[model samples]
Target: MIDLLKEWIINIASLVLFITAVEMLLPDNSLKKYSKFVLGLILMTVLINPIIKIFNRNFNISVYSQNISRSIYDEDTAKSIEKYKEESLKNTINNFENNLTQIIGEKLKEEFNLSNNKLEVKAEYVTQESKFEIKYIKVGINSGKVQKVEKVKVNIGEKNIEEKDKLHDDIKSYLSKELKVQEKIITIYKL
Candidate 1:
């Protein structure tokens, strides 16, 4: 409660300071003749700014809580999976990460016309039951706009390795079409 109060006080104080600075910048005669203009500026700063901030805060809080809940559920499920307990699983996951990075880098360069230096890629593997699920997160810079791509689940089952490869290829094809980049330029991470 105290922390929330402190934050509110700080935000209100900042808004007041911002409004006062703008008021001070105007010519003295102008402010005197057009006091209504000063009142309008103050109203916008004090009312609209806080309303916008409230909506932003609400959105962020909901998003953060949802992510936290999902992560907790995933961790619990992973703990019960037999494959995740095996020592070899770690090495397999590491190799998968390396492979995904290379693939994603190549794809980004070809499909999105992205430079290798401007692409950021991250991949991780999450296990459920006997299957491995890959998650890929990528950011590509093209013409100053940062395009973000995420694939939440890619199945890599031991008996379906060929199918998994096909899925990966399909993802590359889809991203190339959607992002208007060459299929070679899109990067896929194992995560």
Candidate 2:
């Protein structure tokens, strides 16, 4: 170690002397500035050589570079995985809503005899419970369309008016029971 220190000092001294000599010989021109910059770099390298040697004894450049690349690749892969998860979740929610709407439309036609209708289901995933929750449902039906003909011997005018009002409540109650949600979350409108 003592011999290495002595050699390092000698190398630094020689580099400094050479730099001084070169600076003195160069004329005052554009090249003088460039030469001085190069000499300064050489001086810095010589001065730092011993410290570099000591630290570099155990340092493997290839292994260090590989580790760096691996970390970067891992970060990129994690981001891609997160993005994929978000897209998959979005698609799942959309498909669930569409299928539910189709089922609701079919049921309305079969049970209520109402064909001209539009259904919108609002739902979201509850992260805390790890389940999906229905937020609200809106059903639009045209009143002028054909409805279920119930055969009851009563005043037809009053019965028809009563049926029109009761239809909204009945639809809301039906959807509430079928969806397992509160009655208030379902809304029916005559379009």
Candidate 1: global Cα-lDDT?
0.58
Instruction: Tell me model 2's lDDT, rounded to 2 decimals.
Output: 0.81
Tens digit of per-residue lDDT, candidate 2, span 73-142: 8978999999999998888888888888998888888889888797899888788998888887888887
Cα TM-score per model: 0.28, 0.53
Model 1 — which ten-residue stretch has the worst lDDT? 158-167
Model 1, span 1-191: residue lDDT tens: 57766766787778677667766776778555576467566556555544556667554545766999898779568766756666567777777666755665576667655554343433345545555444444443344455567454566764322223554576667666654556654554342
With a 3 Å backbone cut-off (N, CA, C), the pairs that clash in candidate 2 are none
TM-score of 2: 0.53
